[model samples]
Target: MKILILGIDGYLGWPLALKMGSKGHEVIGIDNLSTRKFSEEVGSDSAFPLPSPSDRVKEAKKILGINIDFYVKDANDMEFLKETIRKHKPDVIVHFAEQRSAPYSMKDYNHAQYTLDNNLGTTLKLIYAVNEIDPSIHILKMGTMGEYGTPSLDIPESPFVEANINNKKDKIIFPRWGGSIYHWSKIFDTDLLLYFNQIFGLTVTDIMQGPVYGTRTTEITEEGLRTRFDFDETWGTVVNRFCVEAVLGLPLTPYGKGGQTRGFISLEDSMEALRTLIENPPKTGEYRLVHQFAEIYSVNKIAEVVKNAAESLGMSTEIKHVDNPRIEAEEHYYNPEIKILPSLGFKPKKNLKDEVKIILEDLIPYKSRLERYKDSIMPKTKWKK
Candidate 1:
């Protein structure tokens, strides 16, 4: 199968490309390198230095004997994107190219606008490009669990809910409202994909993923093939941030009462989920939604896990309650269904403790770099005025 991965320079994208190439698939990777540039602009560069895309492809060929064609281009440019699509004519398109940080989107007006434009514009262009070339191309877009926010009811894999109005029965996509501008952009992407599927018979799969943690994968061993690892408040997820704090001997910062519960997945599990979806393409004119997560943990629970992991390794860590900066519920109901991938023979291998141990050991060599950016680990962006 020919696979094209956008945002192939991302934390998840880089590893996915390697996995696909190793599986004897023809892989073409594309990225604009915006995430790296954004991290530099915000003083939160990756803890581990990353090789350029060209260097990475060159190294993979020499070491793994896998050839991956890589191109540096912006996906928002309709003309360039269409040309690439037509040239490659991929069987599956994995769309991971977006500004993927809630706090970064809420930093200011400019950041918010950039997130909205870049994320939505790219999806819109992809829809058009696929429609023009071949509607049979399966599009696997990366959606977020944040798009559902804190709804009153349990979240389903597909947001569609059964409804009866005036003795007439119908099923509709659940009402979606996001917590931040970044999440809102994902909601827009979901709706747009549904529209394209309905109108143009496009086959699309939107993986509503949870917060992903860890920095290691089976295919990524050498330093040159490593994915970027960011542990700052802006780009880091809660679990990743907590592990870094434990390693640095700093208090695990929990916002408010720390009752915020969310789903999480190890980096290895995330890659498997993508692979499963790519192999099993949905039927034509199908807009499939699969909630991709391994386990669920609250903010306080994760902090305690990190603390315990550190203590077992002969290191003491602290947990501190910090003032909440985001405009979200301190405590709420969050039950999300994620049985689709498991039913498809995808099993999550690593638990929270296992993931923490892997991440802590991986960062041992970068202790100095972690300490240098420790001051920027606290939340600085607020969602409210």
Candidate 2:
């Protein structure tokens, strides 16, 4: 199968490309290096310097000796994106392209506008390009569990069925009202997927994933080692940040009452979920929203876990209650039911002490670069009025 991965340089994208290539798939990767610049502009870069996508290909070819094609193009440009899709004729497209950080999105007006425009613009271009090129090229987009706020009850698997007026029972993909700009962009992304499915009968699999944790995948050895992982406020997941803080002897910055909960996935499990979904595309004209994750943990729980992990590793840590910078619930009922992907043969790997250990190993050398900025760290991206 010909698999095309957009944003091939990101924390997840790079490893995912390697995973697919290792599976003997003909892979073509593309990225504009926007994430590298964005990481620098935001004051938080990767733990180790990551090679450019080209250098990554060189490294992979040198080690794996499997030829992988790469293109440096922006998905926002419809003509370029369309031409690539038409030429590559990718059987599947794993779309991990977008501005990922909530804090980065809320940095300022210019940043906010850039996030909105870049995310939505690229999504629109991809949808149109896929329609024009090949609707069968399944687009598996990543969405956030943050899009589903800490509801005061159990959240059903991606869609909830409702018996409405006149006893009409219809299923609906779970409605998403995101808490931050990063998540809102993902909501708009699902809308694009649904529209394309409606109009052009495109196949889409939007995985509503949670804060993905862990750094290295099985495919990444210490050598052939241009693959990068970030543990910064900009691109870092919550668990990643807490682990870094624990290692640095910083207080676990538990915002608000620390009851806000989100689903979490190990880095290994994330790769498997994507691979499983891509192999099984949604039926034409159908957009499947699977709540993709293993377990849910609250902010306090994460802080506690971090503290424990730190103590076990013989590091001192504390949980300091910071004023919740972002607007969100402190204590809320959050029981999100996510079983679809697991049923599709996705056995989630355990992400407890051992998982934290793996991430700490990757981040130890770059500990000096971890910022202590509490002000610009939390989710604060407001919706456009």
Candidate 3:
């Protein structure tokens, strides 16, 4: 299969590209390196240095004998995106090019607008480009579970509800609300893909993923092939942040009541789920939704797991509850169905403790870097003024 992956420099994008390439797929990657730039602007760069995208590709060919074609172009650029698709005529298009940080999106008006434009605009362009070039091409878009907020009922993969109005019966996509501007953009993406699929017969798969945390994958064992790992307040996920705090002997900062429960997946499992979906794609004119996560854990439980793991390794750690910066339900019902992946042969090897232990062990060598940027690890971006 000829696979074209956008945002190839991202935490997941880089690893996915290599994994697919290793499997003998003709892989092409595109990115503007904006994630790295965004981290630099917010004083939250990756904990360790990462090689340039081109350098990494070159090294992969040198060491692993896998050839990956890379282009440093923005996916939102309609002209470039269309031309690339027309040129490659890809069998699969994996879209991951967007501003993905909830806190960063809420930083200010400019950041919010940028997030909206970059995320939605890119999807809009992809829809049109695929429609014009080849509607049969499979599009796998990355979405967030945060789009559902904290619904009262267990979240379905593709939710639908029946309604009756004026003695008329109809079924509609389940009503959803986002927790932040970034999540709202993903919601828009979901709707746009559905619209395109219904009208133009576009084949699409939207993976609503949870918080992903891990430092390594099978295909990314070498230094040059490593993916970016952020551990700051703005860009880091909770698991990553907790691991870094433990390494620095700093208290884990659990926001508000520390009862915000959310789903999580290890990096290895995320890649495997993606691979499973790619091998067995949805039929044309179909918009499929797969919930991607391995386990569910509350913020307090996550903190406790990290603390216990660190203590077992002869390290002291603490937990501290701070005011929640985002306007969200700190304690709410969160049971999202995620049986689709496992049914498709997606077996996750690591549990919560194993995942946390892996991250803690990986960060032990980066303690100096964590200490230097310790002050920037506290939550500062508020959703409301």
Which parts of model 2 have CA positions greater than 4 angstroms off?
166-173, 223-226, 369-385
- Candidate 1 ranges with C-alpha deviation above 4 Å: none
* Candidate 1 C-alpha lDDT tens digits along 1-385: 9999989999999899988899998999789999999998778788899998889999889888899988898888889888888898899999998999999999999999999999999999899899999989999999999999988888888858888978899999888889899999999999999888889999999999999998988988889889999889899899888888888999999999999988899999999889999998888878999999889999999998889888988779899999999988989998988778878899988888888987888887898988988987998887777
Candidate RMSDs in order: 1.1, 2.6, 1.2
Model 2, position 5, has a per-residue lDDT of 86
Ranking by TM-score: 1, 3, 2
State the lDDT of candidate 2 residue by residue for 1-385, as single tens digits. Answer: 8988888877788878888888888888778888788866656666667776677788888886667888888877778788788888899888888988887787678887998999999888888888877777788888777877776666776554564746877766565677777778888888778777788988888888887888777777754554655556667677877887776767778877888877788888888888888777777667788888888788899888778877877788889887776777888777887778877877887775678876766666666665533333443444332
- TM-score of model 3 vs. true structure: 0.98
- Candidate 1: residue 94 lDDT (0-100): 96
Candidate 3 residues 200-241, lDDT tens each? Answer: 999999999999999988888777888999988889999999
TM-score of every model versus the real structure: 0.98, 0.92, 0.98
lDDT of each: 0.90, 0.77, 0.90
| lDDT of model 3, residue 186 | 95
Counting clashing residue pairs in each candidate, in order, gives: 0, 0, 0
Candidate 1 differs from the real structure by a C-alpha RMSD in angstroms, to one decimal, of 1.1
